[model samples]
Target: AAPAAAAAAVHEVTCSAPVNIAVIKYWGKRDTALVLPTNSSLSVTLSQDHLRSTTTVRCVAADEAGDRLWLNGKEESIAASKRLRNVLADARRLRRAAEAADPALPALAELPLRICSVNNFPTAAGLASSASGFACLTYALHTLYSLPLSVSEASRLARVGSGSACRSLFGGFVAWEMGQRDDGADSMAVQVASETHWPDMEALILVVSDARKDTGSTEGMQQTVETSTLLRERIASVVPRRMRQMTAAIHARDFDSFAELTMADSNQFHAVCLDTYPPIFYMNDISRAIIRLVTAYNRLFIKPVAAADAAGDSAPAATSRGYRAAYTYDAGPNAVLYLPREHVTEVLGLVNHFFPPPAAADHAEYFGRAASAFLPAVDPAKVAALAAQIGFAPFPAGSLQRIISTHVGDGPRVLARGHVESVSLLSATGL
Candidate 1:
């Protein structure tokens, strides 16, 4: 009994995972039960410094209650979620296999587990919160049991919860390959580039609304599959070619090609959503306005390059005026604009001019990460000229709730066990 107690004491672990914005979005499913995708997808994992989901798992006494889970400070019935059960079962299976190979391993498999998870950002609001949530849960479980699964194998574990969650297992740019097998053994996420490979890649998440999405991803996907013919065209012809082009773009660090692919794919995915029976409208008027804003902003850089080419200027200077920003949307109204580090301040200033915050909003919480740098005011002349070019005026104040500035970042990380503030969820609600 004493040895068992000692072993249980050592079985706790805390881990956090980053939210990834899919540039080449995943829409429908091939296999609903296994959580397989209809097409391969790619995404950029956002830095956890600004957004993340943190989870802590620990073994409870055998005499205690059954396996349980608490999310965002509310206790939920763990047995009610098949996705949660599948992940827990897979982790135990791996732990048992490891223990059988090594007889010295502690016997912690039969003990009940208490898991508590929370996201720093909004949940179920079309912000890829599920990606971080499941990734953090699976990672914490793997660490708690000392499972011997590789990162790739760990990603497969995350996939059973949420399809995009698999991509969050790797850092930087990642691709979830839509494998050909029915068993889903080949369907896994692979890293295309490390976070440091493209240090200049940065993003701004303009959160239009934090309220829960009206239709969840699973239901929306099912509806699209049964009704939309465009999804068939996307799966058959569009995604595969784009996957190759996107992978190559990331490798070569070619922002022009990368931006083009990112924007086109986002548009098509939303188009497929609209083609669904009765249609699903994820983007509001605010979302459409932001899209136009990005289009005009990109065009502002085009004129200079066109003139440089007409003048037969050197290649170096002409290329410097290439596309500076790309915008993509997930299954929500929020917009994530990817840009070079140099352009963040200027573009944000434009956003400030157009989507000015409400008078009651706290100025301190308005911008995040690299965007916290004092914004150099954009020239009013430039803003007015660009607005005229797009044929749209500035939006009402508070059209956007907040903007989070982050960069490409690494995958899941285990937090130090002694960090009391970070681990407060475990005891705060008595999980």
Candidate 2:
């Protein structure tokens, strides 16, 4: 009998995608099925340290009945959802083209792929998991198949899974256009500025709240799409203007313009949330308190800077600059603060001060306090004391789980050569 063909060398490809927080948030979708956005949105891609997803896609020759995927070691049921399969199918179609002239294209079409993915940060703690997930998946597949698609084309495909996922396709400043097309072919992401373009910019992700959100973005957007008229005004007027301003801010490296647009867009998105008919609540007391702390800090320093400018006591040109800290939020309670890396330690120290972890004793007491009520219970007399002690405002002790710090980074990269590394293999016994 012919010796069994030497087991084909296992082929593997690894890719990574960074998490992105929207500055001009995409709340409602115009076409849910196509994952089209109601309005254009902008996002800043964080470094690998704060939030990211890495995926390895490998093809192996096997029975052609079905495909499989394993995420973080546990076998995932691809039948439960079509999202992963759709990505895999696209990859296989591209790989099949290479097989036309040669018989050894790794049999990608008949072979099942084993995919393993892991997120370095909290999955759904408002940290933009969908952004990283779809980005990693599409990137891994593209690498495995050697697809000849640009980042924009891949981003358009990623959007079918999640609206904001499209933005994760690039690093630094990115914008997802709400293209006026029926097929969604034109709706995709484009890079406004690469990370290298803004070398000093950094994003500090504050994990103010880690609890699973009550409303998934899908459900929340669907509700907003049907019930909110305010959404109409936002999509038609506010978002368009903000999109233009944000793009300009990124291009010119105007921190003042960037910060203003970022904060305003965030507030407006949350406002749209509150404007929903039944009222979807995303921010809690902790979120509001963080907002207040940031605003107060800006006001305190900004007023002084302005005064210094008027008195000619500071650098005239620099005095015209704005506050360094810019805040934005998504559908969850987490906050992304954009600042210069030179000030990262200082900003983080300030954030940790105002939002201290709740004392074990205070956790029960602060569970459901509203923004106004919670402020008084924190001991006004002790406010200064705590601020002095921590070097920033003191949050309810134990309120925060932990803080994740990251900066702007690249989109996806391929790490494996074809057919040389296998991610999985069936045993001879076929267990």
Candidate 3:
């Protein structure tokens, strides 16, 4: 075993965190500076295998130049970012507190930090890039400084950077509690269930466009807060009730309830955006087309099942229930569909049939690397049948940029030194 003092001398750490897509969307903030939310929100953390942000933090010699940050291998000025500064200060405070109790620990809080972060997926494209980025950064800071912050405490530090980032600290189902405290001390995320709680849940991300969204989420939501009357009613009445029901549905693994709530919240979130003064439009025509396609697919796939199959019955009557997939959108045109693992191939096939990529687009390019093998060969006969059933034509090629096939996944994790060596920007850039 290593000596106890050696741990305090560590100067660098690397960590990776997964992106989380909210089923019950979070919009508007009570405190912009604190990144506190007006309503509690729930999200499913996506697999890091498909989408993740990796950050490496190193304590460097004190410099009058101050700390430096590089995002996706590009240098970015961190001095103007108050949120990033707050996260660093809070982590340093925690480290100082730990050293106060243990005199042997080094005084590392005063050292400057060099942070390098990169995302496998597109940044600022409504994929919760900031959430994963900040989560990874905060987690790495705690590791580098050898702080004793619990997951909940670490989540609060992450929240100061991005509200959704707090939820990225936990695996599977997570809920961000909008606390009433004025100082924002109580506003933190709680785990609803672990990643293994509901193993069959899977997600399909339909990337309508990877280009940067026309309107950023923070600016757009603030506009909605100031002008949209529907948002007021939603915050007052709809969210509280839906939060309770959504929690129940997740615990029960009831797909019908979960699907309905997911779609409803997403629809209302976008509607609130539209109601904003001057009207903010996040969903493009392609986004609307995906919504209609998912709705029709869910409706048209109702195959009657014998009651005897569901429950032993003497006179086994028939009952129909069809909810193969549920779709939700953040403040962008991309659609994330949640469904059972058994239904992944079918739902993906339906998407590929209606929204075929260009003939020239590589299979790995259209469907993410992890999902390439799962992409089923298109069947023209089945496509024709589905087209006739739903009365919707196939979209033009290239309407969708890609499909990310992932599932519920664990939270942030410290990366091994060997793994960090391969992807660390510090090593790659020789900085």
Candidate 4:
């Protein structure tokens, strides 16, 4: 047995990773266990300040016991979670090489890890929660052992946990290229641009439902692969072309092409879901309403944006005429909107108008289901007034629960490592 001092000695690091919403959705998997996507995908990583997973990993001397993970204060068995096991194993494997190269490396890899992860946004709400969750865990592990793995290699480790997670390891725009090799060696995420490159890119996350997804991404995609014949044609023909267009759009900073391709790909992905046998409907009534609203909003600025693009800063109408925004969704009902910073106020104002605040009598609903479900930063007084004027727009109060406003952001970041004592999630309950 280890000494009491050694038992209490836990080396830990807290890492935060941003959530990524795929514009070119990775809906089907070629290899389930290996997590190889059927087609390549692209995404914009949201700012960590708004939606992220802050995971703290503690490594101490231990027996052959398995690793453990706790999310949002609830302990989850690591053994039962294959995704988690793969993530930890990848990090430890990389650490082994590092230890061989440097003898001074700590023996943290030999010990079991205690991981505590918390997310500011709802879990499994079609917002790519797993993307940030596993990315943050792997990052904490990489930092704890001080491994020298490249960003791409580290992202590969996260891909084993969630396909979309690979992109979370990078910031701004990311592309998860589905490698052709069966070994999946070349299959990894690549950054399209840094957060600093496109300073105006913004994300408006609409929380349609905060509840756990009725059908998880893995399960839903698995079913679609088996039942939907359309999935094959999409991987073979549709995604390849879409990926090219999206890549070009990002490189050129062409918001018009970016918006068109993003919305088109989203619609096609959902269309594939419907073409599946027994059919899967990831988008509900609320999700459809959001699509209509976003389309209407974009109409105001599309012509202006196009004119501006054609003129390239010469057009006077370009500055104020168009709405530089688009919306996309994943395997759930939630909506992720992409827009420029100049229009956030107007768009948010419209959002408030549609989903107004509840009456004072419904305080519990706001603090309870509404609170846990959404995080719209609008003033309650304003919402109450909007509710009176709109008289219930399409759905009820909780239908559009939260609105997360963020933008193109960098990848996993190490926050305040020097002040470890303060950032510790374990706090007084020290490991």
Whole-model lDDT values for every prediction: 0.86, 0.72, 0.84, 0.77
Give the per-residue lDDT digits (tens) of candidate 4, residues 105-145.
65667788777899987787777888999889878777888
Candidate 2's C-alpha runs over 4 A off are 1-7, 93-107, 303-319, 358-393, 418-431
28-82: candidate 1 lDDT, tens digit per residue: 9989989889999999999999889999887776787689888998899987999
- Of 1 and 4, the candidate ahead on TM-score is 1
Task: Name the better of 1 and 2 by TM-score.
Answer: 1
- RMSDs, each prediction? 4.1, 7.3, 4.9, 5.9
Give TM-scores for every candidate, taking all chains together and pairing residue i with residue i.
Answer: 0.92, 0.82, 0.90, 0.84
Output candidate 1 Cα RMSD.
Answer: 4.1
Better of 1 and 3 by lDDT: 1
Show pairs that collide, candidate 3: none
For model 2, the local distance difference test gives 0.72
For lDDT, the strongest prediction is 1
| Candidate 3 per-residue lDDT over residues 1-431, each given as its tens digit | 14675543437778899999999989999999999998999999999998999998877656634788999989988888899999999998888888888887776788887888999988987899999999999888877877776797789999999999999999999999989998899999999989999999999898988889898888888999999999999999888878887887788787866887899999999999999997999888888888887887787665555422211112212233567899999988899999999988877877877898878987876777545456677667666666776676888888888888899999999884422566555753225
Which of candidates 3 and 4 reaches a greater TM-score? Answer: 3
lDDT of 2 by residue, 250-353 (tens): 87777766787789889988888888778888888777777876776565445443332221222223333547688888888877788876656555555645
